[model samples]
Target: MAVSFHVRSSSYPSRQHPQAAHVDEQLTRLRSSETASSSSIRQRLSNLQDLHDSLEKMIRLSVTNHALSQDQIEKVLDGSIKILDLCNVAKDALSQMKEGLMEIQSILRRKRGDISAEVKKYLASRKFLKKSFQKVLKSLKTSQNKNNNDALAVFGEAETVTIALFETLFSFMSGSKACGKWSLVSKMMSQSKVTCETDANEFTRVDMEFQSEKSLQMEDVQNLESCIQDLEDGIGSLSKSLIKYRVSILNI
Candidate 1:
């Protein structure tokens, strides 16, 4: 019975042992795990590459913004320089205007002084002429009273006095060379005032002392007429002279 239970050795595989089978299965599982780990590493590396590209783009943007800011700063600095140049030009123009105003003020002051001096001189000359004429007439009257041939001598003296008074009055009045020249007695009559008779009547009414026969005659009437004509001419000349002088000053 023991001999019938014995196994045949030729039916079993030579390399196939129970321990060896378990080792093969373990090695296959380990290979599959290593392949899965390699796939996970490749995924991590791809994510890192994306992050690096984003960082590079951000850096480029920062550089561009910085360049634009620098350009804006340069433009502001250039504008400031131009503004400063304009300010300097305006300052120069203001200074020149100030100087011009000062010069104009100086000229006005000088002209005012000159006008004041001319006016003073003109007034003094008029005052002297009035005083001198009064004194001359008083002295002639005193001389006539002392003479023995009083009436005849007074007539000659009066005529001489009238002529001298005419020359003095004309010179004081007329501004031009017209004062130096005179016409003869006959020529003067033609140019005389047409109201001579009215003037004589007026003179006679005013001067009561000259109404006496001893003092007034045909010659005295002629002399009086001549004196009246001379006085009228003098007044006209003085008016024209004053007006002309004023006009000349305004022109200057």
Candidate 2:
């Protein structure tokens, strides 16, 4: 679900962070980024970083504590926990996929190990991870929070956006759910010239090629390796921002 983090004009006139509107702009861009391609996901992560940076600024103001009750704070904490879990799982998958990619790269480079067997094992591991990620992805719903025009509401909505973004990314990683689930993104896809930088399903392509009469290529392994590195770096940065966010809310 998309959310604007700008403080509402009506809600006790919450203290406004200078970049709150900027955060909303980033949020809009992220919502429109329907494809979880490596480039798009990296862009989304950059937007998330900006949004969270604004959040940290907003957190420092007195209104943050006044707008939130103990119960509401706990709710935010629950969502925060989910965000960390989602982030961690992604990190784990990327790490594993990178390791597997390296193994395949080594096999291609030195003709070490049964290449076909190693390829099969890598594909199988990815398939298993995809199956497991399904459950986690389902929990990241597109929220439609009413009266969500204030910063406190934004805090919760931020969590929703975080979840929804991850849902799209993981969906791409699994290569299962079509973009149609997010109707706006699907609709924009036809008009959008920008798609994934090397689609996450590139691994599936590599696996398919390996299974075919055609032998493995170093180019395939290297391309996927580059994509994974991009994702890993983005996720690591997001993870740090998310942790700081958790700390900010608690201190409030």
Candidate 3:
């Protein structure tokens, strides 16, 4: 009779391999979790970038509106000033004509109607004088009318341009999708900023609420909230600056 000892093959997994297998499983799970978390974070970052882009576009439009308003207002003012100058020029020309006429009358009185040959010669030379006078009169009338028409057109253009800018600003500010006055637009912009901030804060709070309580520390919560607050402040500041720029342009 032979004594037999039973030997088990290591091929059958047992406690010895269980530890290594458990570690591999844990690593796989961790990698999966990290990939999911990274994807979620990437999505959130994309959303934030989109929001930033929208805000920047709004700010750029506001600046454009302000510049257009200022340019139109300046044009209006310059047109008015030019009209004033033209009026003065016309007045001065008329006064000079009157003085020249008076001097001619005085000279005719000295001639006593039976003027000498020298006086006749002077009268013949006066043809050039008469032509110059006619030319001056024609030029003055045409210039004055042209200036007046140009001023009118400029004023009309300014008014149209300003109105367009106002409509654009109002649409952005009010979010009402309707055109309105500047004062109304300003108030709407302020109110809209407040609403956006409140909504952002609410969204952040909700995001926090969705996270597992065990995973989030108080510090993480505070940092996320601070980021929301900063975004709100930045948007509000931009709105205020836009309003101020419009106001200053109107004053000018």
lDDT of 1: 0.30
Candidate 2 residues 1-252, lDDT tens each? 323233567656755455656566666676566565657677887788777777777676675667677777787778878888888999999899889888878877896778777778888888889887887766555444454546556776576667767866777677553452344333332334434433336555666676683866677778778877888888888888878887998998
Q: After superposition, how far is residue 98 of candidate 1 from its true place, in Å?
A: 62
Ranking by lDDT: 2, 3, 1
In model 3, the worst 10-residue window by lDDT is: 29-38
List ranges where model 1 is wrong by over 4 Å.
Answer: 1-215
Q: Model-by-model lDDT, in order?
A: 0.30, 0.69, 0.32
TM-score of 2: 0.81
Q: Write down the TM-score for model 3.
A: 0.22
Model 1 superposed RMSD (Cα): 61.7
Model 3 residue pairs with clashes: none
**Model 3 C-alpha lDDT per residue in residues 34-133, reported as the tens digit of each score:** 1112122233223323322332232233332343454455654444343334323323432433343334345545755432333344333334444543
In candidate 3, clashing pairs total 0
